[model samples]
Target: MNTAVPLDAQSRRALLQRISDILLRPAPTWLRIDAEGTSAAQLYKNYLIYLAAIPALASFIGMSLVGVGAFGMRLRVPIAAGLVNLLVGYVLTLVMVYVMALIANALAPRFQGRRDMPSALKLVAYGATAGLLAGALGIVPALGMLAAVGGLYSIYLIYLGAPVLMKVPRERAVAYTAVLLLCGAVAGMLVGWLTALATPGAGLGQRGAATLRLPGTDIRIDAHSVGQASRRLQEAQREGDGGAATRAATDAIGAMLGARIDTGQMDQASRQLEQARARGDSEAAAEAAGSMVSAALGGKGLPPLSAQQLRAVTPEQFAGLPRTAIKAETNNVMGMAFTQVDARYSQQRQQVQLRLKDLGAAPALAMGMASWASSTSESEDEREIERSYKKAGVAFREKYRKDGSRSELSILLPTRVVLEASGSLPIDELKQALQPVVQQTTALARPPA
Candidate 1:
């Protein structure tokens, strides 16, 4: 077993550069490796130990500060528990990489490749660069999908490395890569099982976060709110209100990034406002106040509606359904309210959701539905609602009238009205149930108010 000088500074730097090259330029990168005199111990000491630490540290920080955001909610893990999970997962990943290298050696002979143990180690260690570096993505839980995408790219690295490191023929490289991948998968599951056994509480992706709660008014925020604020800030900037624009931009960034974002600038802005007020500078004081309001509440605050506005947004009703079948719907979003009336039923293991949102929220809801309906992947069978209304679409499933099939219908009516009906029902029955509602809603929508 040959080894490089343990304390050589240049070797350490070379290791870091190699990790970067493998991650960024993997296609030609693998062909450049010498793969000579590489051994399991040397690989582990020089590369695996150092490179694998990136994910562990990343996960620890990600879990502690910016936890996962999914299904319209955010979850955070305790720092102590996140640290433990990180350490355990780190050890497991290191072991998994080594085990995959051994598996590569075992599969090499079938592909007519030379039985070189050092080369196999190089293949596994370097091929994992994309996935290893993607650990930093976990810090922003919303970007986890990007990390998964990065991991998928690592498969290509493995494919490219097979021929260079394993000496497999080009035609046999894919097969060799596939078999080794299968082995890695089995090894991963086995290692995970063992890790779970050893650490009872530190299961992968599990965190001790609080239960999901409906966001309170002015408390809960997400990426959408941040984006809205950014647009508002840009508008303010365009209007030459520099102080207001700066305040709006900061609030927007803080909402999207996290509340833990530094507030020193915001504090400074507040101080400037106070100083201006003390000096009897009314214009500066008013500008500062505008900035503070912009930061505190973007776009007139949550739900962006008022009780008077809700009252003015009239409801649409269905004529065929019994009065008993119809119900008024109100969603109290963080104290911001959106009201509508709906008609629904359950039969034959199927359900229907027929809703009419009022003027206040209808246009936005219609836009969202229209966007989904127009998507190429949503459903193949889509068509215009009717000659009367232009901005509407209906997507139907195959055999939609059959017992288990489904369909979705959306129409943007006049006066900012939105009509939506979705269900799994016989196509004839769904049409019958929806026609009267559509007709009534459309009739009301077509006439000028």
Candidate 2:
């Protein structure tokens, strides 16, 4: 009787454990997509699209919980419309994706899974992460490059997640994803390049695709034509092609100024002349315009712009040179790194020059305009630091009052460069690169008179 009781007790314990295991088991997330019995190949494109939209879908869900109406706020149609568009996009993509999966399954025919659709959906969803990363890079304005990058990243996600999503082995999924992204990127780039080439006047007007895959590198470049054009304009600035640079700068500035004058417009022509003059480049631009007018009115064919006319371009040329040596150095470093980093800075500087392009009477750019703007007062901290060194007494320099006029544009830069210049040595080369305290101490004691 004891043996029988023990056996029964053991069985009961086993039964209880089994019940617990079943209860605790996690539910699978991939929904069986085709209970409605649609064929697989037809669902490919829609499925792919849905996967891309899911992140936005998840975000919308969270956002909806804020309940503006419950709080007595008026409804905004834009928010709802955007959400609906996203949702509809998601649904459509899912349908196409399922169709894509069926095509693959049919070709193989050895696929024995409870529901292949779930795995395919999951795979696409995973790939979407890579695309999202690429999208984040969309901030860099040159070609829809930022967006292209994000999209490219999504493809990588697809590649990385495919194995898990499709229930395929890692190697196979990676191979598939890699192949798809590579092919897609190439096709996309070729199409964009061809489209740009085909457009009128080398296609500077319509927006270019902002994202592109650089040859041999996974890095994405500008994709959209407009962004591409903007980047090109920006690039021309860095190269310092005076004529092209001015044209690019003016176009960008004009957009900001909302003046809407193209080079062809007489008013645009006049405004350009005015902008040059305003920057102290006015005299030079005027001379150049005068020379052009002279050539039209029968002067010796326009010689390289006279020295007088050249002055106008200088304001545009050195548009954003740093106010201090430190900023200059940092700016220089940003230019040196990345193959085109310098170009980026030049582009920015040109833009600054063209718009705020010339130095105003603002204290930041008041260096040349004023005889002596940098004279410092004998602050308490400066006195303490100086007195301590002279008397051999312990002392520390106190900080000065913050300058309200200081702005990102006006102030000196920090030590580090966002991008390290190519071929820079780690060893200390500059005094600034050395320990800050040491530099600070040295700075406290003035150099030989």
lDDT top scorer = 1
lDDT of 2 by residue, 1-449 (tens): 01112226665574344323211110111122212333334323323332244334533443443322211322332556546633543443343333434433332222122236545544443334334333322222222222322332233334334444455454343323333332333344554455345432322322322223211112222233224345655576467665665465444322221112222332233345455656778465665444322221122211121222212222222222331111111111101111111211224222111111111111111111111112221223321211001112211111222331111111111211111111121112211222332233223321122
- Model 1 lDDT, residue 88, Cα: 71
Q: How high is the lDDT of residue 414 in model 1?
A: 42
Q: Could you estimate the TM-score for every candidate?
A: 0.44, 0.26
Estimate the lDDT of model 1: 0.52
Which 10 consecutive residues of model 2 have the lowest summed lDDT?
331-340
Flag regions of model 2 displaced more than 4 Å. 1-126, 129-156, 164-167, 197-449
Cα error of candidate 1 at position 299, Å: 39
TM-score of 2: 0.26
Superposing every Cα of model 2 onto the true structure, what RMSD results?
A: 28.0
Candidate 1: stretches off by over 4 Å: 1-9, 70-74, 201-449
